[model samples]
Target: MDAAFAEYLDEFTRRDWETLDPDAVADPVRVAVVGLGWFAREWALPGIARSAYTEATVVTDVDAGAVEAVAAERDLTGVTPEELRSGAAADEYDAVYVATPNATHLEYVEAAAAQGKAVLCEKPLEVTPERARELVAACHDAGVPLMVGYRMQTDPAVRRLRDLLDAGVAGDVIHVHATMSQTMLGELGSDTDQWRLDPELSGGCAVMDLGVYPLNTTRFALREDPVRVSGRTRSEHEAFADVDEHASFRLEFPGDVDAFCTVSQNAQHASRLEVTGTDARLILDPAFYEREDRGFAVVRDGTRVDVDFEQVHQIEEEFAYFGHQLLAGEPFHADGEHALTDMRALDGVYESAETGRPVELGD
Candidate 1:
């Protein structure tokens, strides 16, 4: 190989290398999906099908009709949430995936923990930090492994970015700017009665649902937590009256690393995360949504080096990672305690938004 070309290939090894294995495992972990929402039915189910380490063997939902339809179509066992809690199908699966609304996580997790089954709950663990603590404690007490679905941690590009930052490829990080937004009503087919529009179910709105992506991703990449936060929110739509439609917040991490983030449930679709370092800039365009194409690059010294890796379904990677950990008896990176920190940060943001002042989160 040419020396220059060999060095270029080495750059890719340093910047973007495949980290996930997609080959089928000898014994896959059986999962019972607890919710049949669009994301569960669409992305998550398909992702599970593609994963080598996991398989969906059972399903349940509050809506009997939806559950029946999905179970029949996929040839999966359909059970009531009550039956699951009662341990009727306890032997059929090794893990329970809780994808229900934000506030309803505790009951499902408690049920699964009682059955001595592992759990994979979607983020932000629960609507509030208090409930999140309870959920974490439940799994801890049961002596079962608990993983929160922060799928960004499993993305190949994101994993590579974290490695580069750790290697000082971007030098010391100074600041970060991120934004994520989309038209919520249209995405739900304009259903005014959706849970996301409800304050109690969705946990105060756009920031909880959308902004947490950037916030959590930042924490994962930097391996640091924010120590202070300032926030503001507004809602003009009738459907969003009880929740926020738009939100913007500034977070200050230790070492003077600051982040500015904006999110909206009623705006043009956009997502981006830019990290400014002393010697270079790293950008992940179309960062949050798993459905969008991702672009990552580092810019320095009047030159740009784009990192490329095979893009797999990020949710699929998430499931695969969880299953592999359970099968190998390894600990998870996105455990319950890791998610609780984000929940605390989110609670602080809401408080800051309401009080028109900065909120301090002890380091």
Candidate 2:
């Protein structure tokens, strides 16, 4: 970590917000939503509407019609993009969720921090490590929380996996293999020029979009940074010339554990992670950071222990947790610094792929 970021983390860790009483607080945590896109309309707004600790006070987007429609649908007052851009609406909210395209995260995050509002930004926090660090610094200097949308942190299955690993049940994790792919053709049909297809906006291709999940999952599971990464890419469509349609990478983490990840925008379906350890192997099906039925099978010497659940809604749980933290003035768990660490790992992978050589992460 950079010196400034390290200092910020130290300061954050030293503060305690759990002791604060939510009921004693005079006002609810006012929140504003930026970018009324698909994810915002479909997932984020519903989650926020259902959260009790925070109120959706305003919604903003470049398209007035879209913003107005979403605001009316969710029964929220609308804030125009002009108002947000000119800082007129900054003080109206205690926090802002930037659900814009990947490329716009930094600008919105910085703007929110400048306005003294905490921020929750969509994934791939920023396109580059420097940008991510700058956002982290801005939030730190403002003394406001900046959270990334890594919803897996709150998933029940993930929580269980973390507990099992920490308890030494998965004993000395040796290797991890994960794959995530989706049929993007229908989604991207004719709209090949969509922001997600644009390298400048999406950061990379399938790797940055879908691959970040497994990358983050592996990192979280091991609770360690990868030391090195090697990757290769393949493309089936011309629209993906600047991006990748499919890619696979190998990551070497500390303690000699290896992680193999594959992500694609052109595949038929998805596959989850399989973690191998000295004592057992854990298979997690229907992975990715959503609330879905996930099957966990523990195999020891060819004997299997199956674990299953009715699938928990991760977005709801994630927003609920964030609401509680916000209500209590608690620091964000998936804070900007943590997001920066994940972005650094992403940078290494991209660099490795471009240079055709394993990239080493610097401490």
Candidate 3:
């Protein structure tokens, strides 16, 4: 066995979710979801609605009609984002899910934290690292648990891959490759002014919207921060005047491991991670930190190993786990430091693209 894998196996063991007794916990958490947009409705709300550990207390959005429509359809109560921000509408719930645009995450998180409520904010916690750090510190001071929506961490396939790495099954990870892309919003007939294409709101184009997925997944899978980053980007449509339509970057980690990730709003579909290690290689397809139809693949010494897993909804599992952690007063899995790292890496990617040089991460 590889020495690093042996060491990991000695320190940590993979957890079995099935063996866990569901009835061991009490008091389902009351959760209020802010932002009833695309993701909030498609993934977040439905996932939470199906979970046994949480109650969807309220749904809020800037568009009252949108929120009210979802509320009526789902039989949920609706609150205005303004009301939520003013704290008058938040007292009814124990937690808040912030699914607003990237620019508004900090404000919503701050408001939620001020109410001493635990929060799960969608990815790229804030537009900048400084803002992310401030929000993190505020949550810390308020003694509220803050978790970013890196739902891949809760995915069984991802969990299994992490286990293999830790168990030395894949030996020492040498390099990681990832690709996450989707058709352009304009091509999909989406409004040109969609927040995702607005750099001012989404932070960047493809990088922040889809690139962050692979970026965060790489960091989580390796459990290391990139020391340096290099990247490039391009845009085809004038509507995406402020943001790139496609972007690619290379990241260098501490132990000489490297990761290459590319994200594009111009691509046909998406791809997952292809990790190469000294002893073996593992491939996770359709890996967007979300639930997948087929499971992940493990190859050891030229032999393909199939790891069977049930389709576990990441959003549901993540919220459930967060609720349990909150009830138990345990530290959050995706904490402030994690959110800041994502932003810092994002900053580096932008810097690298502009300067045509590798940007060293950190202040």
Candidate 4:
């Protein structure tokens, strides 16, 4: 390996190195990465590659050129998604990592379950609630572990925020306000992965991609699902004619806990999540993915307490958590059900946005 790549790999795995022990991780699931996209290569796989408890044995991607390049770099063979599911290569790995775009999640998930292979799929689980629930249920019936990759939920800073809430430092989660925005697609639909501009491929714009952080993290922090949701989706720029370029929504929890979020495809970069309670309020600055540093602050009547956690490698935390569940022989945190909950809430958000009315939710 080149020295630069070697250094990068070391840095990637060093932070979360001791998170999992190979010996303690029973049956130690090996991974077959089904997509070699940006997240799969730079963010997800590097951790899997360096993890002691898990190994990536094979990979598959629709982009043949990308897959071939990755295969050569990693010295691993690439297979077709079909081959990964049930062809000659079916039994080669213990789990599958589904990192394809939003729309294609269900297909890979179902295929993985058909072979009784455990899966760790990326966020939005599936673009639609029905498919999300079906995939989760299928994995359940097939007796396979299904985990959705919500990296921010595993963040140390985010975890500390949760701890504070759990400890009642925040009294009760009376309200939460979060906003995530970036201008990655400056030219709008003209950017790479232009497919994302297609509502069919992206599900919805900012809400499906960026808003989901606040949407899911609220549930993670409060440990409660919203009882109702209302939102507005808009295509601010002509460039995003087909898909929403920006979205803002509000979620109402059972206790009247009010959570509001703003996500956009074209905006000055900002990522923040703050939760308010009777006694105090907690804040997470730069709270989502790809942030260089995520910091937390808590404020009481007249006092402010701040915590700056060392950046934890969320991918390692995710893999370690999954491995721990495998060793313990049980479904645990961030399981399929967890993803389903977020999907249900998101479903309502979309409905409310489309109907210009509040959509109620249950369970």
Candidate 5:
């Protein structure tokens, strides 16, 4: 734990920890959301508003006018990135929520960490592994908490499956398959310069954007990193004229388990996860983006297991967990190292795809 936050705990006794007012800790972590993009406005902001451990303290972006507009609507003070860079603005929050473009995420993370605030960065930490390593190092040097926003890990079904794996309910995992696809080609359009379409800026579209869900889920299920990866890419639509519209990859984990992932920007709405072990298998439908809103079934042995999870908003659940782990002074699950590990495997996926060969991974 950082000395800064540790001091706060010194004020509380063990009894205080147990009897402390829940409302006192509710929205205890003041968060500065660094972007006003779609995800930020629609998902992250609302989640913070409803969180028991976090509150939206500030909103920032390079475009002052747009930020000001959002500030007016959300009753938040909008600050510009340039203002933060020039030190015109003081750090006013406990942590940062980075929902900016992939290219700009590291800068905001570093800026927030400069003031010793924790950070929750959106998924696919960087366009490349090198930048991800740098971000991880920055958080380490600052001694601030760093969590990657792999919200799938917050889902009840996903967590239950992870538990089952730990309990050996699925016996020994033998094979896994994950698929995440949406008709995003139309949403992203065919613009060659769109941030999502530009490999240099947003990284590869389907693989880097949507592929991380399956890849990370596989690792979470196994609780181990892939020793090797084999990948291949195909472009079947003009919508992805400049980038690969589809990518398929494989991860070789220990115990001779193989994980196959298929990703696409042109496919229909398809999000499913399956894991086969020696004794049984677990299946998750609409896996990547599932909340209890429309019930996500956890099927095993040809029957629906009656697992119950509180139906809180997905983002709220994630932020609540982040806040809990931070205040408890513990290492988090989706830490920088976790994201960096995913980046390494993802980088290997691309390399293998390009060379049409399997890329061996290293610890």
Candidate 6:
């Protein structure tokens, strides 16, 4: 290889690739999980159990029976949501992990904030941007930390991509293409009456649920919020009558960076993201979904080089990062205000789709 080319490659590889070390905290954060739904049971609980910096000390839900069963099975204290809100077991946990439906997030988050507990609310912040603002204000008023669970931020590959972009390895980013889809009905199998189909509970179907992966992931990688959006959506099936089954949106960011994103709840399972810049293109195929393996590559001058990163339990990393921030008394990057940006941008997408025009997001 030529000397100049070798030096360039060396510089590219040496760029800061640092990622959060979740095990930095010596003390674990005691957590009370505020919902016992399928995601909480299947992913959140297991992830907390495996995390080095956090542990589930209490569990609660609206359903008393599910709370009892989960608490017993996990050897955790069981409490009703009302009891938790009333501070009956306030001393048991230092934080609350809320995994409830979209619209119900504010209630549990307010209760947690009232008790001065840090909150790790699942994504979208809340059903609407207005409600999300309320939730953020609640946490701010109580002077407690509030983090939205955007697990992609904790993934090492995604963080590495961010570092590379920040290092100018990709030059000036020109555009991004992202799409995420899943066969929701195929996976759930006739459970069409679930809360996901209810607009009130889920906010929206594909856009709010599946679409946020690309939208938030791009924001994290680019460190830029979208300034405007144009969107389109379709919901044909009876199950999706109240919400969108397919949605597409375009985002305009600062510095002329634009993104085209698509999401579907009725399509075959897939996730892919690509960012093209003047210098090279970065790709993360099979992107958003939690997986045991992730593919990453960089293409420059028609030469493709794949990069390997450590495989991690994304949810566990999220829990550990939350715990580390709490134990260290550090400000979180994905705090409530950060989440509010995405919430507002998402609201813009919906408004644009409904009105058949572009929506501008205000700071």
Task: Give the runs in model 4 whose Cα sits over 4 Å from its true position.
Answer: 1-27, 186-193
User: Considering lDDT, which of the candidate structures 4 and 5 is the better prediction for this target?
Assistant: 4
Model 1 residue 146 lDDT score: 100
lDDT (Cα, tens digit) per residue for candidate 2, span 32-119: 9899887777778777766556677889998899977877887887878768856787667788888888888888888888888878
Tell me the alpha-carbon RMSD of every candidate: 2.8, 7.2, 3.4, 6.9, 7.5, 3.0
**Candidate 5 ranges with C-alpha deviation above 4 Å:** 1-22, 187-193, 290-310
lDDT per residue as tens, model 1, 104-192:
99999999999999999999889999999999999999999999999888887777677768877679999999999999888757888
- lDDT, model 6: 0.87
Candidates' C-alpha lDDT: 0.88, 0.77, 0.80, 0.78, 0.77, 0.87
**What TM-score goes with each of the models?**
0.94, 0.89, 0.91, 0.89, 0.88, 0.93
lDDT per residue (tens digit) for residues 133-168 in model 4: 888888999988888887776666676677668767
**Which tens-of-lDDT digit does each residue in 1-363 have in candidate 6?**
235333333433221322446546566889999888878998899899898789999999889999989988989999988899999999999999999889999999999999999999999898899999999999999999999999998887787777778877789999999999888988656689888899999999898998889999999999999999999999888889999999999999999899999999999888999999999898989799875466788888889887655567778878878887777677788999999989988888899999999999998
The global Cα lDDT (0 to 1) of model 4 is: 0.78
| Candidate 2: stretches off by over 4 Å | 1-28, 187-190, 289-291
RMSD of 3: 3.4
Candidate 1: give its CA RMSD in angstroms.
Answer: 2.8
lDDT of 2 at 234: 80
Per-residue error (Å), model 5, residue 171? 1.3
Residue 353 of model 3, lDDT score? 95
- Superpose all Cα atoms of candidate 4 onto the true structure and report the RMSD in Å to 1 decimal: 6.9
Model 3 residue pairs with clashes: 5-168
Pairs with backbone N, CA or C atoms under 3 Å apart (clashes), candidate 4: none
